[model samples]
Target: MVVEIVQDKEIWDRFIDESPYGLIFHKWEFLKIVEKYSGYTLYPCGVFRGDILIGVFPLYYKRNMAFKAIFSPPPQSGIPYLGFVMSSEYNGLKQDKKEVFLNQVVDEINDYIELASPNYVSISTVSNFIDIRPFKWNNFEVVPNYNYVIHLDEDLDSIWNGFKKNLRKQLSRPEILDLRLVPSEDMSLFYNLAKQRYEEQGLTYPIYSIEYLEDLFRVYPNHLRLYYLYYGDDLLGSITTQEYKRYILWMGNTRIPDNIFGNEYIIWHLIQKAKEEGYLNFEITGANKKNLCQFKTKFNPTLEICYNVCRKDTLGKLAETTYQKFVRKAG
Candidate 1:
């Protein structure tokens, strides 16, 4: 197939929108934001048989600033997630013939990379445990990404029963708190509070900047929102929601202490809001392996495993191995 890059948004959006099995990442809105914010460069190559598009590989180029001066322009950051969205099932290419199309698409991408001579390329959140071919690009590296998910399909009564005693009491005593779940217009408050807590704990806040949140608000106001748990004038907690077809991902959350705001109450209210919006599932950003898993089980949502796909050089791999060995020996 002769591949061509699509420059027109309308055509691309129409094609992906009509697809049966689609992911939010493949949607035009997401690509537009990534393109707008990152602005490295967009190489959206389409595999077409004559006039019809069969597959597309979207990628962006970025300089490796950490290793700057060591290599010119360095390696490109990555495509974010081009491979997962390639199948015809997700992009209106051809559903029944997905395997054949996928293989062809992968080969074409590899060939394209070689021809273009990009220093490095990678994809993220491609779960190695559940994906079809976890690491199709033998040359890249792989990392495991864990995301905490709360199952919501089960009856609420059954879910309520599973919560820890204290959490259950908190939910039962919701009337005790004067907290209101209000749609927040100002994200700066939440960002500053979250940043402050992170600084106090000597940690980096793991999230996009306030500017990106504002951009998302402007772009997808209906599908995404910033909700706050407010006690009169004080903002107790805030959460960012990413609404997709079947699930509402709790992208981020921040809270202050004193228990006056009720952290659990904020979560419960978010759940109620998601239900009201007709979402089937809610995801809590994952923490560690044990406590988070146990905590999320109270919600009774199905466990959805998330993974990170990484690409490491030979020396980097060796360094990782040595670090792991040192930790094990220390233990």
Candidate 2:
């Protein structure tokens, strides 16, 4: 297989859409938006066997006078995973055949890494991409990350019953309080809430723009939305969800009046909505963080693991250590 920058948007997107490992994060439109906001150059790379594309890996490269960095989802993009995804047929192949193709793809990726020689590299592989040995073979370090998932195959009642006792009580609070979960295209309200709350906490949130979200909403109306929690006419809080193969609690699930139990109310309704729409799973991302794991674990959902494969050179190691010290001290 030969690896090169894929230029045809239609071919690349079609392959990604059909791939079992593909997520909305793998799409060209999403990557373009991420590139603009992250200030990284988008590289939609492809591995092709003769005339057919076998895999696509969309990466973001950042270059400056001080350093060069590479990321799949990019830092601060709020994307949980964005790595290479294989073709649909790749999944049906026998184990040996699959590894052969995967090995070649990883080799090509390594070749590119060698040529570019970025100081640091990180790739958060999608949940379905289980084989990390190929990447590990190339000297990448594997770090485990977690995401909380609610399997929605069963009926809503069964799903509700599976929640912890305290969670059931929390879910019931909304019914008595007269709060409404209204779905809307109001990206402005959600963005304002997120931006203001982060500022109030003395945190900087420059990862996304209103235009970036607006563009995403415009491009994928069916796949992304904002659900506002309203007490009569007053907005208590809001959340954003992304619907692809799985329904993802994408952002804005916090900074609400904690006393009202608004997060529990809105997210419960969203889970029901996702199940009704035939989604097989609801993913409450950010479980890797201690603060989030405590709150998200209340639902009694299954904990899932994903790999963050990373590598750094000598200078990169020093830079990363310095960056980590600054972050830890600040926290």
Candidate 3:
């Protein structure tokens, strides 16, 4: 088997769209959207046995000043949370034959990474493929990226049974609550509302700007949607949902009216829309924030961990070791 690094989109489009294994991240259209918005160089590395494309690892190059490597370039997001995406569906389908696929994928990707020559390589949000032992790293950190999902194969009633009792009730409530979910391209309004809510509560605004968001929205089109909540013409809440590959990621939401507006209700509404749009799952994104975790639990979705794998420069390795040694000595 031989691996090839396909930089052209036309070739990748055909492969992803045609592959029986169904690789999502390796799809050319997806890569184009990401590269257009994030400006990350998309490397579509795949393994071919004779004439057939067998396995692929979709990777991007980035750098960070904090982790200077043994060899180097300018810094980037390392493994930007969203970049190292793989097709979970594909991985699941090929699980039994994964060893062969895994070896081919890594061999190709390792070569691709070396050409980029990043001293550090990081990957995250890996799904079931980790069981195949996907990648080996010098240092790694693992943490839960809790996601909420509802089985759409059944009727809404059956799906409701899967949600938390309170959540189901909230979704079914018809108390004439003056809430409205407006779907629109006016993402500026959503950003302003979210920013105000964040500042009012003394929370730092995210690194993303309205322009950046608009750029992202334009690139992904229906793949990512924006919705704002209103109460009798008063903007109450806002949410950004991204339908990446198979998962509908409820990326960010904010309630201007705070607890009085029922943030949970807003989320349930989003999940229902995701269901209506035929999404298989809803990702609540990551965990670590105590308050965030508490809020995520209300939906009653299965919880799973998201890991960060890190590689250190000589200096970073020494510092990390020293820090650990110091903590151990203190203990």
Return the top candidate by lDDT: 2
Candidate 2 pairs with clashing backbones: none
The numbered model that scores best in TM-score is 2
Give TM-scores for every candidate, taking all chains together and pairing residue i with residue i: 0.74, 0.91, 0.73
Model 2, CA-based lDDT:
0.82
Q: How do the residues 222-271 of candidate 2 rate in per-residue lDDT, one tens digit apiece?
A: 88877888877777888888898889998874545666777787778889
lDDT agreement with native, every candidate: 0.57, 0.82, 0.55
- State the displacement of the C-alpha of residue 247, model 2, in Å, after optimal TM-score superposition: 0.7
Q: What is the lDDT of residue 239 in candidate 3?
A: 69
Error of 2 at 212 (Å): 1.8
Score candidate 3 by lDDT: 0.55
Which residues of candidate 2, in runs, are more than 4 Å off?
174-177, 257-259, 321-331
lDDT of 1 by residue, 1-331 (tens): 7667788877676666554333455566666665565545556667776778765556555444431111111122112223434434443445556556666665666576556444444555422125445245545455555655565676666666766677777667755367787886687887787767766765555444677557666776776677777776766667667666544445455555645536677777777666777776666666447865675666554555544444445544554476455532322
Best-to-worst ranking by TM-score: 2, 1, 3
User: Which pairs, if any, clash in model 3?
Assistant: 63-75, 63-76, 64-75, 64-76
**Candidate 1: residue 167 Cα off by (Å):** 3.5
